[model samples]
Every structure is written in C-alpha cells, then in structure tokens.
Target: MVAARITVNGKETPISPAAPHTTVLDFLRERGLTGTKEGCAEGECGACSILVARPGVNKPTDWVAVNACLVPVAALDGQEVVTSEGLATAGEPGKPSTLHPVQEEMAVRGGSQCGYCTPGFVCSMAAEYYRPDRCAHADADGHTDAEHGPNGFDLHALSGNLCRCTGYRPIRDAAFAVGTPTEEDPLARRREQAPPAPAATEYTQDDSAFVRKSTLEETLRLLRERPDAVVVAGS
Candidate 1:
C-alpha cells in the first residue's frame, strides 16, 4: 500500500493504503462530497469535471478540469482541489457569503434545473473566475475569463457539464452575465479573484513520465536514488 496526501476543498487529508486503482469520483463520494456528480464517466462528458489545483514546476499553479471518474485517486496527492461543495463562502453550510460569482449569477440567470449539474458547472466556473490572468486567454477562446467576456457566451468553459433541461443558452448567458465584483460584498470579490501566493512550492512530481513499480522494495530503491523524483510505486 502507498500513502498520499491532498487538500480537498481547502482541507488536507491523508490517503494511506489507498487502492492503486481508485478513481477520484469514488474517493470524493466515499468521503461524502457527493456534490461532484458523474454522468458519462468518460472525459468526453463534462459531468464529472472538477478543478484540480496542483503546485506547478514552471507556471504559477496548474488548475484544470479533470474527469474524476476516469482519474485515479492516487493522482490527487498534495494538491488543492475544489468541488461544487466548496462553492459557498466560509459560513453556514450552503450559505451564500462567498458564493462563487458563477453560482450567484447562475442562480439569478436561471441556469440550473434539477440541480444535479449545478455543482459541476459551479466548479468549472469557479476555476475560471478565480484566475485573474486567465480571463484574457479564456476571452480569446471566445469564453474569456473577463467578468464581461461575452454577452451570449460560448460553451467552451462549460463544455464539460451536460444540461438536458436548460439547453445551455441560459447557462451560457448566466456565466457571461456575471458582473464585475462590487463593494457590496468584499468577501465575494476575494473569492472571485484571489491573489496568488508569494512563494511557490514544488508541490507535485511529474507523473507523466513515471512508470509503475511492481514491488515495494523496488519503489523504495527508486525513491532512495531519486529523492526528489515522483514515483508511483503502487496503488
């Protein structure tokens, strides 16, 4: 068995003796964060899209959408993850204090139905909203991260969420409709666009080149040889 640590929402937890093949959806659902839903289970469908923020080697931080159902639980070690459950600000459960601007705008714009897909869309939008510099690029993609990137908006950011009820037009509208942060709520503004940390840490190892080890001894030897290396010894 292997041990791993990760921050869920904003808290850190350890996954020791974790099964080698556990998917992220299984881990979150098992841990009681059911806000993250699953529809197609494959990466093609954005139903399981969740924003994963991991310490980066080159960039400020790497946050992207991932198909939780297909993603292995072991991949989440030492990262900051935010789910639909993390949408609300720091307050009463489900309170709207720091309600992600996307969620707030979505609520006013009638972007949700049945509510199952709301969380996924919330998570995706939160990632887009949180990154200040992303708006310019997201804007170029036709979905710009700008508070007012597009009026009708594009399905590029939310392509991961599949909503059969709203037909996506209203949802897109709501996403683009989110206005600039106002002084009415300072917390809301903080959540929408957070400043980056002054210091950058080497929070993750490049798993793209890592090959699985067949035995514990081999894994130990590998780690000893390359102390800074990221090795996926086992599940």
Candidate 2:
C-alpha cells in the first residue's frame, strides 16, 4: 500500500515520478544535489561517489562508498543514502554548518581544485575514515608505508577517485590528516547500530514495474512466471 521510498541525507523521498531506469545520480541531481557529478556515465570515474550504510565485518554498519551513476534509483528502495551535502552538521539559524572531518581536512590541505571530483573524493575518504579496522590495523603494524598513512589510512581507499588539476599530494595529505571520529560524532555512533534492513518493493509507473521480493523462494517463483525478467545483482 505504501509507495517505495529512500532516505537521502535523513530525508525520506518517494521514488516515483522518476522512471525505473533512472540512476541514483540523476535522482539526487534532480532534487538539487549537484555535488554528485557525472564525469563518465560509466562507473570508471569516481565522480558520483556517495556513502551507503551496509553490514560491516567489524561494526554493525559500515559507511560504504559507491558510485551513484551505476545504481538505479529503484534498486535502492527503502535504503539510506548520504551525499556530500549531508556530511556537514547544520548550524543554528543564520550560522554556517560545521564541516565533517574529511571535508575540513580537504579544505585546509588544498585537496580541491575546480571542485568537480572533490565531493567524490570526500565521500570515498569518509568511508575509509569510518572503517572500524583502519586504526587497529595501523596500530598493529606500528609503521607507515607508501600506501598507508601513519594514522592507519590506506591510500588504496582512494584508488578509484582521480583528479586532473590538483595533484595528489594535497589529497593524500588531507586523507592522512583526518583523525578518528569523536564519541559525539553521530555518523560514528551509527556504526554501533544495525544498518537498515532491505525492503521488499513493488513499484510501477508508466507501465514499467520494478520489484524486489522479500525472499528467494518468491523471487524464484517470479522468475519462473516471468521468463523475460532480468536479474540484477548488487544494483
């Protein structure tokens, strides 16, 4: 009875009006979230990175960075997403919002240039920042390497993001400079709780339908009924 929806930056939005094939990037952009760029429609460019909460190995939820251009809006029914604009904490009326640790480091360290890829880089870096094992692994190793920072930041976390004008030194500096999340950090505290459970959705508009069954048995039954249905994994 209820329409399919997604929670973006803590706001619940209905996923209708947009077509079933609309990418997450387009959906967000249509709502004035211009930070998610589309450098390449293909997933090769990391210009459309966004944070997604998913099951984690060490913590209850992990802030996972994913390419928005590659995922359909319909596939994220009942999911929660955080764009670059959502990273900052809102200030009191008329006051400027406080930046997240990753954004602060990036600004102070000159990590942005032209500002196209900066948001994507920030999202990816934030994902690594919230990684539960990052600090523990660094402490265990007790030594920094070319690919890992002294603070346990693995440079590989940013391998997908690319910059054309700004050199990587500043970006690397920013990534290495971010400190651990404080106890008061809401995003950090979210790790203690479970990520949102997947929702079974059946959304239709303009004669096109998108469905997500609650169980494998129902899915298999639907597949048998509709032989033309295409399966999409991890959409």
Among these predicted structures, which one has the highest lDDT?
A: 2
| Highest-scoring model, TM-score | 2
User: Which tens-of-lDDT digit does each residue in 17-73 have in candidate 2?
Assistant: 999888999999999999999988888779999999899899999999999999989
lDDT of 2: 0.91
TM-score, each model? 0.66, 0.95
Query: Which clashing pairs does model 1 show?
Result: 20-235, 46-160, 135-145, 138-144, 139-144
lDDT of 1 by residue, 72-165 (tens): 6655655556677775667777764666678888888888888777778777766555443443234445654433455433346676677867
Whole-model lDDT per candidate: 0.62, 0.91
Reference-based TM-score, model 1: 0.66
Model 2 error, position 90 (Å): 0.7
> What TM-score does prediction 2 earn?
0.95
